[model samples]
Every structure is written in structure tokens, then in C-alpha cells.
Target: MLYLFGAIALFVIFDSVRGYLKTEDKRKYLVRLFLELTVVIGLLFLFGPLFVLSPLKIGYSTLKEGNITLYYPGGSIDMARDVMEQLKQAAEMNRQFYKANYPMPVVLAQSEFDMLRFGSYPYGGGTGSELSLNIRAGQMTTGKIAHEMSHRNLAMLTGKSMPAPNWFNEGLASYIGKMDEYKKPNELQVDLREGRYVRDILEMRGILGTPKWILKIRQGKGRVLYGQTYLMVKYLFDKYGQEKVYDFVVSLKTNDFEKAFWQSFGMSEEEFFQEFTSYIQNYRGEPS
Candidate 1:
């Protein structure tokens, strides 16, 4: 509807300009064009912040405590309070991991459509920025919030213009959130053995640049990519220690991620990938 309305507005402006160019009655055209423009502008103002107005339409209520602000549907105050608590806990966990604190906004969406209204991906949960999350209203959980909070914390710790590689970014989050234990080492070993996982680390750099990654998630093929990345990050933290990893992430604020990786880890990304890939391929454990 917004696109359609914008197209109509463009047509109106074009038609008005053409009429002004051709008109013998200049004063009449000027007056008519002014009115048309006024109407279009008025409608634009009315519709521009539709997402802001949606809360009122849905009888949503706001809750605030310290740095966390939550918007939830009316009659769900109890649930909203629970979400706020979860956010607080998630924030604390991230603060301990990152050694810093940041404020975040959370929206408890009654449905995926509600999540979309707030510019959040509606698949279970999503974040709009380093400091905002939209979660399916009733499905909020510790692991999910932790996952998103890790993303937010890392974003806060690093430069936005040049982000860390996709694999590192998501792998760190999944590792911190502890959400991929279900993926299982045996399953990853199968993917590795079958040549189904990411073959090159460069391919993992911007994996989310295409819609196919999300499609893979929906098709239940995400475990391979996510699981492999998680293990890779786990490998870094385990072998290099947390402080070194922290230094690398913090260096991103001043350096390109590749430069930071070299400075802190003492190796190129390819070197690390080769090391990690070999490690994971040889990792064997009883299936969980």
C-alpha cells in the first residue's frame, strides 16, 4: 500500500508539472498544483509513521525498567513483565561477556505481522539494531534472548561500517547464547564427511547476503552452516583464550576485521579456517 501510494504521488507530481508546462492559465495551474501537493504531503505525513501508530491501534502498552523498554499488547502485562526480566538477565550475561553495558529496546509481538510492523524479522525473533529486538510474544526464552543480546553486545563493541565476518558474528552469538547444542557434533561430522558444510571460509564471510541462507534455515539445512561456525568460534575461544578474542573484537572499532584478526590472532583468516576445519573433521564424540 505504501508503494502504491508513493507511485500515485509520483504520478500526481509529474502530471501537475506537465500541466504547468502546457497551461495557458498559469495562475489556475499554480493554484491547482499547490492544492494537489498539499494533499499528497498531508497523506504522506499521516502514513509515514504507520508503525508508530500501530501500537495505539493494537492497544499496546509500554513498560520501562532501567535501560530496557518493552512494548507489548494490552492484557499481557504479566507476560511483558516476564520479558523485561528476561531482557535484564540477557543484558547482564552479555555485559559479563563483553565487559560493557548498553541499553536495548524490546517489542513483544503478538504475531509475526506485529514483529514486521516494528521492522524486525518475524521468524521467532529478530533485532533491528544493536539495541532493539522484536520477539514473538509468547515464545520468549532464555536462549533466544541470549542469542540476540550477544549480537547486540558485539555490535556495540565493534564498528558498524565494517562489521566482523558473518561466520564470526553469528558463530560468536550462537556460542554465547548456547543455542546450538542441539545441532550435535556427530551431525556436524556427517556434514563434514559428506562435504555439505561450508567448504571455504570466504564463503562464510557474508553468508547472509542472499536469501538462500534464510531459506536453508527454513528447510532445516541451517544446522550445517550454523553448527560449523559455532564450532569454529568455539575453537578460537578455547585455543586462544577469551581475552585475546575480546581484543580482536574490540580492535574492530578501529581496524578492519581482517586487520584485527591478524593483529590479535597472529594469523590470517584462512589459516584459522584450515586449522578449525581440520580440528572439527577429526573431532569424535558419542552422539548426543
Candidate 2:
């Protein structure tokens, strides 16, 4: 839709310029050009930041360190430096943990409003190679940086077209980022006991990392989904070890995720899910 709108706007501008060059009526051409320009500006407002020209809407200072490049607005250079350092640490941690490296472009939004204007929220978002973070939202942490970088790293390693399951992606990222620690054990216990936790395997596998899922987090229902998946990945890590997990992620480059899982873990994903949920249910102690 953005592309189509852009093409139409360009055509309108081109045609208007041609008409102005040839036509004898300068007054009429000026009127038409004003209307056409208005339409183009209106289209930009309608499309918001998803339009290709969205990045140009803000003035960003660039900072580079290794494979990471930071873009931050004015008056936030200190925060940008902090973000760059954290991002560097996160990338190194991911490489050590997952044995994967990917170039990342990080955007530090000075406020929630800036974040929203950039097509993200206060928390932050990872769209494959790029990450947007709201540094002023009091949500910035090393774990959060690691979490988004994990997503980008996996996307690079696995290939975006056939990426792993959303639940796995989010869970592993949460585990790596330590975002799971935000949810208290007692709180998770209440969720599990009150039947508010993820139950169906299909539900777990289909859990998305989109904005709607973020809305669920805002509504207080997302903790279970995120918490459960984090525990799931943590469970595998505790039982199998990071080497097996790394192998599984690396195998995703060639094999389907389920196939890679079975080859790496000696159990089907369904079997693992059953075992994990049962472990959660039968354990006589605090979960995780």
C-alpha cells in the first residue's frame, strides 16, 4: 500500500511538472500543483511511518561500533551511548550463547511518542535486522537489548522466510534476555493454578510477537504466554545444555525446525511439549 501510494504521488508530481513546462496557463498549473502536493502530504499522514520516507521525518545522529550502528535523536546522545554499549554486550552474549553473529541497526527513541511515530511502542521492537527502543520509557535494560538482538540473530541464522515457531523464537529470546525474571514465581504459580496459563500446544506454537500480542501484555494476559515459553526454553537448557540448543538453532539453516529439534534432542516437539507441561504440573516445588 505504501509503495502504491508513493508511485501515484510520484506520477502526479511528474505529470504536474511536465504540464507546467508545456502548458500556457501558469495560474491553473500552480493550483493543480498545490492540490497534488496536498494530496501527497495527506497520503504521508495516512501511511504514517511505514512509508519509505518515514526515517527522514526525524533527525538522527549516527554512532557506529563494530557491526552495530546506533541512530538517536538530538539531546539523547548519552542514552544512545548507553544503548550502543548494551547492544555490543548483547551481541557478544548472543554470539557466545548461540554461536551466531548478525549486523544490527539500533534506533533509540527518546520518548514513547517518538517510538510510536517510528512504528513501535515504548518497550521496543525487533524487525529482523533493525531494532527500535524507547530509552526514556524506563524499560531499557541489558536483558531487553539481548532479547531484541536474539530475535535479529535468529532471523539472520534461520532465514526469515522459514523462521522457527513464534513461541520458540519469543521464548528463547526471553530466556536469553532474562525478561522471564520480570514475572514473579508466585505470580506464575497463581496463573498456573487458576487455569490462566497456556494449555494447548497449538496455542503455544501460534503465539505471535506482533503488536497485538504486546497489547495482551498490556492487558495483563501476556505474562503467562511469555512466562510459559521462557520456562519451556529454560527447561530445555537445564535438561539438555546450551550446546544442544545451539545445534538445534544452527540446524534451522537447512532443516525444518521440528526436524532439527528431533535430530538434536532425540524427541519430537510434541513429546517435548508434553513432557514440559507435565514437569510444570507435577513438580512439587516452585516452577523454574
lDDT of each: 0.70, 0.68
lDDT of 2 by residue, 39-131 (tens): 767555444344323445346677889887676676667877777778888877788877756777666655656565555554544332323
The CA lDDT at 231 in model 2 is 81
Single out the weakest 10-residue window by summed lDDT for candidate 1: 46-55
Backbone collisions counted per model: 0, 0
Poorest lDDT segment (10 consecutive residues) of candidate 2: 126-135
Model 2, residue 275: distance off in Å is 0.9
Candidate 2 clashing pairs, residues 3+ apart or interchain: none
Instruction: Report residue 112 deviation for candidate 2 (angstroms).
Output: 2.6
What stretches of model 2 exceed 4 Å from their correct place? 1-58, 122-138, 183-189, 204-212, 286-288
